[model samples]
Target: MRLSLNQWTTRRWSVAEAVDGCVRHGLEAIGLWRQNVAEQGLAESVKLVRDAGLRVSSLCRGGFLTTSGKAFAEALDDNRRAIDEAAELEAACLVMVVGGLPGVQPGEPLTAGASRDLAGARERVAEALAELAPYAGERGVKLALEPLHPIYCPDRAVLSTLGQALDLALAHPEEQVGVVVDTFHVWWDPRVFDDIARAGRRIASYQVCDYLHPLPEDVLLGRGMMGDGVIDFKPITRAVLDAGYTGDVEVEIFNADIWAADPDEVVATMKARYEDVVLSRP
Candidate 1:
């Protein structure tokens, strides 16, 4: 496995610290979150990683294209900045988590007319992608559309399957856009293997993490480490490898417990797990 640690998996580590940790653990790549980059300043963040000889596998995200009016406008502007940041960091792609339904702010209630409409939200995401694809291409950043689990469709991402993500990416040129095959999100899909083959060269990023039980109250933090869950790594990994994806294999977990552990220990465990499981098959 071409291992890369996503910054979110060790959220407490700064960009500088994360890079140092990666180097310490013999990792040569990392997936950065926007907030962490902003904290270190874009130039400093880029320098920090480059100075350490680490590759920015992908930038965490650059989408939320479902809101209307000012919210939508702000999302576009933020995404534009995200594209610039990804280019500056020499990242391979900008992962996009296209937003879900409208009017459901974090703590707020859904408004009257802003009911759940999966088709409408997905259409809006496609339109937004059409608008952003050219700009991203100009900046030399491929837009990597990631389909979250169907459970997230109601409140997080409208693109809830790899096939749907590929549909949107195929609308544009291959160089300008691609899909992300994240194991935790797509593992339960009945057609995951076929979709991986179908994704082929359009697959820009491959992420790994296990699916654990005992759902947390905050479901976003429920992801498990690679070998701790029920996911069968060999088949999924073989499918991705067979698809001809040569990019970094990133470990992106959201478990609160993982975040609470020592960053260095987390990376060590991640490396061990990747060696034992992810790399064991392919």
Candidate 2:
């Protein structure tokens, strides 16, 4: 099993340090965040990870194509640069977090105006993908669409289900587009198991993070370490493996507490939990 440690899980670690940390844990794969990569300079960061004998499982993100006018144009330009960076790193995919309705705040009632059109936002995502898919394909990178949970529907992501992500991917060639199956986001879905089966080779990335209840005020930080929350990893991991997804299983947690811990300790705990839960399947 190829296990990957996403940079966000150890948010305090520098790019060079994070690569060494993965090596210390006997891990060969990592998921990198854009901010960390930018801090180190893209070329330098790529060389750092490569020299450490680490593989980038996937790039954290490159999408937010739900706005309009100059803002939407800028988002596309950023995504293009992101694709270039991914290609340079030889990352498995450029994960895309297609944005939700613009100006809509999380857990709050929607405000009227141009941003209130959910359908329009989704249409914009499709259009953005159409423009980006060819660019990614030409550079030998895949665009991985990640669907956030329903609770994040108001602002974080417009895509909210595996099936929906798959539908979007279907519009483009399989090599150019794919879907991400993050346990924390999809575990609560009634159709997740079925969707996983359907995703097949289109499954580009599989991120592992458990979900905790009594969510934090900033719901983004509510991600729990694997096995710490209610997710039953065996079944989900089994389904993913059965789907012919022969890629790294990345542990990506957004919890503030985890971020506060020592990076080395965080990686150690991640390895232990992955072994006991994700890799313990029949």
Candidate 3:
């Protein structure tokens, strides 16, 4: 499988800088974030990546189905715009970080029972996806539902398991909805191998990253580098490959430590580590 890098790892760097770093390290693709693209001008960013001969594996995000009324409408509009941007960028898929909690916004005040409303939040996510899937399908963009780890469930995403993501995908199969399996998130899951088999070809994208410890955030890729973490990546990759997935193994680490360092160094280290730990396996 091909190797890809997520823009989040180099959020401090410009899109051009991130593209340059990834290309220099011989990565096959890069995942772009909406905010960075907005800063660089979508068209110009697309051109820069294409000129570097790098594939746009998937756009970082699109989807916040928390509130109702104007807020919800605005979120839909934002998602539509994101779809247009992904289409223009020629990204393989648009990754969806589906929202969580009824009134919870990132970095906002937490509600007393917010965590208990998981079922409701999941329902809202499903409804929102059902509403947006047709539009994404019409544009020939696959909407990849990424289940964030349970750590983020109370505030970020309610879908915290690959099995749950597959359920959502199967529910909207006609709409081309698929799953984005991130190793950092689901590596420790007991059902990971089974879920990968179930996901089969519907696995739109695969992300790779290691974590030193299971913290909320700030985990570096090298610390969690493939085999270094407790996960058995070779078996996981084998399951995904056996299930017929041929997408890029996109490295996505949200480590503040790595971001503080030079972007080029991060890319080079990640590429070498992925090759030694993930790619070197059968």
**What would the per-residue lDDT of candidate 1 be over residues 94-210, giving only the tens digit for each residue?**
999998788655434577766577778887898888889999999999999999987677677888899999988999998899999999899999988999999899999999999
Provide TM-scores for the models.
Answer: 0.96, 0.96, 0.92
* Candidate 1 ranges with C-alpha deviation above 4 Å: 106-113, 280-282
- TM-score of candidate 1 against the unseen true structure: 0.96
- Tens-digit per-residue lDDT, 108-217, candidate 2: 67666527688899999999999999999999999999999988887879999999999999999999999999999999899999999999999999999999987888
Query: How would the candidate models be sorted by lDDT, starting from the highest?
Result: 2, 1, 3
**Candidate 3: clashing pairs of residues:** 210-224, 211-224
Question: On residues 92-173, what C-alpha lDDT tens digit does candidate 3 reach at each position?
Answer: 8999988877677565667664445767778877778878888998888889999887767766778889999899889776
- Number of backbone-clashing residue pairs for each candidate, in the order shown: 0, 0, 2
Q: Candidate 3: lDDT of 161?
A: 95
Question: In angstroms, how far off is 58's CA in candidate 1?
Answer: 0.6
Once fitted onto the true fold, the runs of candidate 2 whose alpha carbons sit more than 4 angstroms away are: 105-114
Computed on alpha carbons, the lDDT of every model, listed in order, comes to: 0.89, 0.91, 0.81
lDDT of 2 at 158: 90
Clashing pairs in 2: none
Query: Model 3 off-target regions past 4 Å?
Result: 107-116, 214-223
